[model samples]
Target: MSRPRLLPWSNVDGNPCYLLGDGTGSSYLSRVADNVESVQLDMAEELLNHAADLLCDSDSDSKTTSPQLRFLAARLTEALRDVHRIACSRGARLALPDGDDDDDDDDERTDD
Candidate 1:
C-alpha cells in the first residue's frame, strides 16, 4: 500500500480533495500542481495586495499609504492599461447580456 499525498483546500465548507496525477494526464493533481507554481504565486499575491491596498477607495478611518504603495499604484495602473490593450487586440468586446434592458432604444438598432 502507498501513502496518499496531502492537499490543502480553500474552505471549511469545501469537500476533501485527493489529488492523483499521471505525468501527462489532465488530472486535478496535475492542474493543481501547475497552478501552484511558487514564484508566480508569490508574485500574484504581491500584486493582489498591492492593488487592493492602493487602488481601493479609502474609508472614513483609513490612513494614507507609504511611498512604496504610491509606486505600486502607478505600476499597477500601467499594467492594467497594457492588459486592456491586449484584451482589445484579442477582439474582446463587452456586450449587454442576453435580453438585458440596459441599453437605450437608439443603441439597440442594428442593420438587419
Candidate 2:
C-alpha cells in the first residue's frame, strides 16, 4: 500500500489514522485534527490549573498526599501524553512530502 497524504491523529486505541490528500494541511481530517488539538491544549491548561490548586491547598503539604491529588496527577499525565501525541501528528501533517515544495504558507502577505 502507498503512504497516506494526511496524518490526522491516532484512535482511542492508539491506532494510526491516515487520509489521502495533496500534502496541504487543509484537508477535512486535518481540520478535525486541529480542532481536537485545540481542545486538548485547553484541557491541558485546565489540568494545570487544577494541579496548581491542589498544590496550593493548605492541607496539601510536602509531607502528605491525598487520593484526589494522586488521581488528578495520573489523569493530567495521561492527558499530557495524549496532547503530545496529537502535537506530533499535527507536525507530521505540516511536513512537506518528498518532492512537493509548493509553499502553502500561513505567513502574512503584506502589501508594500
Candidate achieving the largest lDDT: 2
Error of 2 at 43 (Å): 0.5
Give all candidate RMSDs, comma-separated. 15.3, 9.0
Would you list the C-alpha lDDT of every candidate in the order shown? 0.50, 0.69
Name the candidate that leads on TM-score: 2
Q: Which 10 successive residues of model 2 have the least lDDT summed? A: 1-10
**Which lDDT tens digits does candidate 2 get at residues 43-83?**
88889887887778677666446877789879898788877
Off by over 4 Å in 2: 1-9, 59-65, 93-112
Our tally of clashes for model 2 stands at 0
Model 1 lDDT-worst window of ten: 1-10
Each candidate structure's TM-score, on Cα atoms with residue i matched to residue i, is 0.30, 0.61
Model 1, 65-93: lDDT tens digits are 57766777776675554444334422322
